[model samples]
Target chain A: MKRFIFLLCLFLPALSWAQLTIQIQKGADKPLSVAIVPLAWNGPSLPEDIASIVGSDLKRSGQFAPLPSGNMLSMPHEASEVVYRDWRALNVDWLVVGKIVPMQNGYTVQYELFDVINQRQVMLDREVGYNDSLRDVAHAISDKVYEKITGIRGIFSLKLLYVSALRDAQGQNTYRLMLSDADGAREQILRTQREPLMTPNWAPDGETIVYVSFETRRPAIYMENLRTRARQQLTNFPGINSSPTFSPDGRKLALVLSKDGNTEIYVMDVATRELTRLTNQIGIDTEPAWTTDGRSILFTSDRGGKPQIYKVSATGGNADRLTFDGTYNARPRAMPDGSGFVYVHRESGDFHIVLQDTKRGVTRPLTQASLDESPSVAPNSAMLIYATLYGGRGILAAVSVDAGSRYLMPSRFGDVREPAWSPFVDRR
Target chain B: MTYKNLGLSLGVVLAMALAGCSSNKAADSANQNGANSGLGSNSSSTFDPSANGNGSNLAQNGRIVYFGYDQATLSSDGQSVLDSNISALKSGSQHIRLEGHADERGTREYNLALGERRANAVLQYLVANGVSKARIETISYGKERPADVGHDESAWSKNRRVEIVLN
Candidate 1:
């Protein structure tokens, strides 16, 4: 369990640290080979695949390589129907089998995970939900199986927010802010405008998200409540009002504003609307992300004459440059554990995602794209997704924290960008 | 209004002389100034400079300015374009919006700031040339509103332009 210090305890009298407590699961490094058989459908219509979601979820974590359905010798829906010798001959370490039965309320999904080497059942779980939320139900089961095996919570239930620029039939480009599942299902449009939207950051509770929208004819940060769909303009500074991120405690926001004549980092208490200036730099100091601890902010700056990750106290002090390996390193997204950070690094004519361990002073590139950007880390710290151009179109791709596993979140339509991974949402 | 006087005072020397003097010398000066005056008509007219055989390019109709890669400061061509837009902007009651833009090469946040810097650079030039601050509003589309969708430098160069949107 991770404990938050309640960074704003002094200012917020009624604040409880319990509400802010969030665990940042360190991802398992050793890859595990697992097999997930296609779930037997008891209903006429199979809205979703519980096995595929669980397989994809586990595969996305960089922890497991799920055997493709075609490669399996037999399809078994339950432990009694399993052929242990066949799976053992296939060299699989773990096996998962499930079946979905349609009920009056929704569907009942029964899944069982087995240790193929031990020839014994490890977990048997059942999940029930409304018919409309079949995708959610699949993710819920994935979460249970993942945590049971990896000892880390699954983030498949968490959603992602991103901006996609698609040209309509009129040949006019329209920008849309979208709310979508991690598995690329049930895409809901939050807002659509001709003007560009950028830099979306999620509030800790996953109830509100703040993003920069140009609908007002200028870049301004707006905080929107997900439940009510109500939005309030947060900042409309004269020069540039963009790049807003919620502090870990959810009490304050760490953002970039140029209202003072130069782009600099600033913080505002969400409740009081009180603004506190952080970095004062002559050069561009933008893209502010709060450290998981909430005591410091990591941001991208060119104070060193080129863009690199820089760190400064959440309250305002001397900014310390954190990167030196590359000529360009910007958009510093600190991991949930604060163990290290992930950033867009430009090296050898390509912009790729890289993870930098602050304590160890080690840097590792996590992607191989020509223009990978807008990396949003999973709540579990197990994986991250970033926007990259594939086949001349913008697409979002995910990679494990260790750069061990990778997959592309299939681009639905148009050019997508600025993926903001939602925090681990509260269970419904 | 004050704008007409300012326009007359700025580069519309012929308009000033035509306003100040008798209509007699105005024809002679118009001939001397050639079609550059009518061809250089600002926001107040339906004249297209391309209509004449001048072949001086679209810069002749000037309200837009272009910049080099990764640069916010205007080039010689950009400065000349702004120089021509001043008189028309002065003569009109319309609010001038300098919509700054950049190529799709950098991060959105940084590009936004860069775009604003480019717009501010143009704003300063207009203010330096006597366009009122109240009559001008600036917005940065950054790389979002690309004039060209191609990925090459040709497309990028076209996208790295600040549109002089006069309303």
Candidate 2:
């Protein structure tokens, strides 16, 4: 009887390991190590692969590092086939294995997460969706897995808006405003013009965009509904009209207009078109960006003898200078957290993007590129996308705030500029 | 009413004759004394010389040249004035700085390049006219620096200028 009991104890652990239970811990000293095995599919080759897309999406977050197949100890297709001891030997805290089985009209995906330390199966998610929705499904799974581990919402479904310019013979320049996935996928042209388009900004709701256009032989601001494709001319003043920014609440727009005899900031109601002047200074007051709270706005002005950032109340009050370090500091875009602002700073005859900490009142250089301009921060404030000249051609590049990861998005048509990251879309 | 009208017309006629006589005398003095004597004095005491052409008021100081919209080509009138000023600087052997500016019509980055091109055009003109390129340096302020506060064509025309300053 004693010999049989010892044998039973040894077999019990092996049985538990095969079940592959995952435990979602509250916090860990470091980010949990996860290994995502390639999905096993028993069907005709699908138009899209979900496993590769999920891996790429998770890796782009910078918080999670997905292990490659070679580093993985065991490739498990089902929950019963997992070897917890192999994964624990590799120091992997979590292991994910999934399979795709073809259904009548679509495909059914079943995935399982295991906790190698506990030697048990923790969670399982199964869904039936179309093949064309594979990327979306992958993003959804990434969000779920990330939130389950990191305790913060993932911005996987957001979008980005940018403007591209192509100059042809006969001196005709074609400008296109494009909308694409946050990862630069599935791009669709929003508007096209033979003239120049500048300063594409997103509304708070993420469904509309405001920008400046020079189609009528003069610069004017316009707002377009992305879904309905309807455009309204926001400003048609006699003089210079540019730099349109939406307020946080989406009820108003703050912009620069020289029709009042000087380039001053103005707040106009989006519905009624009633105007209220904000600044009365005899300086070049342009590039107006609203604070996250919507109580004040930060803009670039030369009132202090050089172009620097100044903040004023949205309802018109005493303006306060915000930047004093560089000889040329302009294009202030407030971060989502309201803790800092990112703008182009010129030092030693080279322009770079720098982050200004509002609390410490100090600026830190973020990029060392020579001519990086027009930086827009992601909705999560983790990365910033901006335009730079690469090999004498304009291209868009993104870099993490810590300068750890960088990527480039070159346009297939022509040069791209003025990238605007949209806020997180409301997922209902 | 009759008295007020008579006084206004009389004031206008008297002002016109006085301005014409003073300009004639100023011209005669300029011919005899040369352009250097007129440098330190206010030229407004004589008739305004920029009334006919779109001459920038900046030229009254004899230290600036203006360009048309989106153009770097020097107008004939602007060239003649800059020629005389360049000759004076060459003869005086003075180091000069040329500050270029642009109107707020294009994007800021493009405007900066445009302003630099305009200033370089002026620099080339000066160098071809026997002025040493080493004696003149150029800095483009782009649209950051504007002399006129308005956004109209009148203001934009005045804002696009290259100011020559002696170092």
Candidate 3:
């Protein structure tokens, strides 16, 4: 009987190991861990650090948590120098390292990603070009790493358009509509005005932007093609034409207009310029944002006596209020999954970012910082970028939806406001 | 009285006028109290200028009008004053510039629209009262200038008004 029991115990262990193998084969497990070592630089101090930015782009996706450089046994600048044993000892599933070398036209950034456990180099890359191309190269590397690990595309190559404000001596307000890399590098100003310009939203294809500007001393919506620098004013209504947002398919624009006695939401056909009023109410209805499916819109209205989030069908219907916990909740940006939305919620008179689950009707406070506003979600729905006041200066900040990752993009110029996260850019 | 004392008193008067020139609070309060005094009402006499600190008095006495948040409609009180002001303007020969203003409630661009609405509301009333529209021109300062320094409700009520300036 004792001999039989001992054999059964040994056999039971083997049976459990077989079950674990089955589970692994069925893809029931966590993702592979990745470690990105700081890249080596051979050129003069770069205009902007590229490796750190790439690492941050990967980290914000929530799929990877970069290990600190101090934990690295040896920093490898080339694929030939990779010591897999060193990374294996640290239990790192993958390793990424590279070096930037000077080139005639610009710079060459050579990088490699290694599967430490497999003892093989997964990605060997060569990005050759100018200083302006470094950011794109970094994004490409990030894309490669992301695809190798998660089997999904990375949106790091996309660009974000935002509004930058400066007050001149003549008491004139100067607004510069700017476009920059997703990592906040390679900033290029698209338009400058002596009046207020706001709500810079990108087109679905990432080639154009639609925003509201007071260039003619009246609130009008304007669309500008980023490549050609051509612009067209969409609305020159007699009263309040503002808060323009593009539909998901880019065929129409959702905007606010008060020409018919009260401010209300309106949808304009991009091709025909025909207008259709969506909301007809006495209260102010503005700040329209389309749902991911483009079937409905979420906007702010004071019909409930205070500013709150309300949802109406894109085809027009009775509006439904979505927020109830706060006295003031505006700027509702829906997540990509249609699962929830993030918006500015007033708590104790200070505005902060809050996430609301649409299905469950549950709200979660994602930020505790004071005065965080204009929260926009990444195309992946993993992170949020918003404009907040830090040290009495306006700066752009990003925070994970789970409240784990946080970072700031402080502009060296004047105040930065109204940061619009671009949709996922398709890489050819 | 000696010339020196008279000159000193005159200097004091000039300083006061300069300081109060831009602020209508002092002048408005004085007028209200002077009206009460003419009725022989010393009972509430010590007349604290700050009692009607809210620009509501400006709207009630036909010197100004108030609008809703992001609105420029003439409230019943605002319409009553405009009704009387139309007759007064028709009798007088002075041309007026209707200066429009808005409270610090909405965005600057929206505020400009609100201010213009307030001015137009009054202009429309005057035109209906047989006053020539050409006699009045309108200008909107939006929320750039405030009649009261406070940021509370009373101050906002006072700031959202249209002042008819005789030119």
Displacement of the residue A426 alpha carbon in candidate 2, Å = 3.2
lDDT of 2 by residue, A1-428 (tens): 99897567445433321111111112222445788888898778887767666666666665556677888767898888998888888888777789988888888888887777988787798866796677666777776666666666666666778887764321234677777666676566666776567779999889989987767644678998876768899888854577788998999999877676557789999999999999988666878888889999988887786778899999998999988887778888888888889988878866788999887877888777666788888877777888876665567877766656666777665578788888876665
Model 3 misplaced regions, further than 4 Å: A1-49, A56-72, A77-80, A88-93, A99-110, A115-128, A147-153, A168-170, B1-21, B25-167
Q: Rank all candidate structures by their TM-score, best first, as comma-separated numbers.
A: 1, 3, 2
Predicted complex 2: DockQ: 0.02
lDDT tens readout by residue for model 3, A1-428? 99897567445423321100000111112435677887898657876566776776676565576677788899999988889899889889889898888877788888888988889988888777577567778787887788777776677887777777654322224577877777675566666776567778888978888987767645578898876758899998865677788899999899877778667899999999999899987666877889999999998887887778899999998999988886778878888879888887878866789999877878888877666877888887767788877665567887767676566776765568678888876556
Q: Per-model C-alpha lDDT, please?
A: 0.75, 0.68, 0.69
Task: Encode model 3's per-residue lDDT on B1-167: one tens digit a residue.
Answer: 12222212221222123233323443444334333333222222121122222222122244566676556778887787677556666765656557578865443334544666688788888888897877776655565444542345765776788866543
Interface RMSD after interface superposition, each candidate: 11.2, 19.7, 15.1
At residue A264, give the lDDT of candidate 1: 84
The per-candidate count of clashes, in order, stands at 0, 8, 0
Error of 2 at A151 (Å): 3.7
TM-score of each: 0.81, 0.67, 0.70
Model 1 chain A worst lDDT window (10 residues): A15-24
Write the candidate numbers in order of decreasing lDDT: 1, 3, 2
TM-score (0 to 1) of chain B for each candidate: 0.64, 0.63, 0.64
Candidates ranked, most accurate by DockQ first: 1, 3, 2
Best by lDDT: 1
Question: 1 or 3, which is superior by TM-score?
Answer: 1
